[model samples]
Target: MTQLSSNQFIRNLTIQDIDDCIILESKGFPPEQRCSPENCRYRLSVASNICLGLFETTPLGDSKLIGHILATKIATERITEAGMGKRIQGVENSGHFENSRNIGIHSVVIDPEYRGVHLGHIFLTKYIEYIRQLKLADKILIINKESLIPFYSKVGFENLGLTDCRFAGLIDYDMVYNL
Candidate 1:
């Protein structure tokens, strides 16, 4: 239950949120770094329960998307292009897992207008708690660039050093948070 205001809250992101998410993706990531529309659709269609959206509801009853996180289950600690890039065969489509102890965080995007206020920190904290509550995995994993290492570290993800996988022409480091 993370909130920016009384009217702002978090919920599972669904297919209905694709357009809003795509817009936010563009604002949050470079052209080569953003997730594709097809991938977004598939993730939402198959695992929306594991994805989350932050929204603000106005007095007029209008709801606006503010930010979101995309994730999937992984069977191993091995980071691969299939999991981060290919999208289809890389991660599990199930919202939760029985044997897999890893949850692969695909993307996290906060609206530029909402950044600089530590909203990403708050949102990620809440997401971690939510997943823990669901018993989704024994640990969570993320592949992020060097510039983002400190940010993810602040949220408790331990850096596992540089990985061989390349995303959008940029090398990423492996990070983990044990449940």
Candidate 2:
């Protein structure tokens, strides 16, 4: 697979990315597994600093958001439906917990054309490094399908076993990468 060109790079996402994010999100997740438009905006408004996006610069100098990892700060070790849902305790409608110790990764999406190019792996590694540098959270958590456990494991995430959190009737494994 071809790699991203030199002009492409990863940066924190902005509210302006919501449209691209929504489009890419639909392509990446199942209906029930997808974050709704409201929640996407909430995550960005509350924690845009952790919403990492991989963008490719076009020949005209405009940037296209191709991939993103949307995360939220929470106190829970294991992810809950509420955590992944639009709102959760301590996450006020207007703001998020400033001292949340754990970072819950809600989504990881790449444009359909960008798949199979190792962009997910590269993006994830860079995310971990970026989070670690900030020292904002003690751990980074994610709930993923069994098929992806190995992929996440490759990025130093340890599978803590099956979780009670069910979405789209698929079994999910709770994984974590300690910073």
Per-residue lDDT of model 2, residues 122-160, tens digit only: 889989989999887899999999899989999899999
- How many pairs of residues collide in each model? 0, 0
Off by over 4 Å in 2: 1-4, 88-96
lDDT of 1 by residue, 1-179 (tens): 23566877999998999999899899999999898897788778767878899898978999988889987676568555666533444455423333567888888989998788788998999999999999977888989999999999999999999987687888889999988
Leading candidate by TM-score: 2
Candidate 2 accuracy as lDDT: 0.85
What's model 1's TM-score? 0.89
| Reference-based TM-score of each model | 0.89, 0.91
The TM-score of candidate 2 is 0.91
The alpha-carbon deviation from the true structure for residue 162 of candidate 1, after best TM-score superposition, in angstroms, is 0.7
Q: Report the C-alpha displacement of residue 59, candidate 2, in angstroms.
A: 1.7
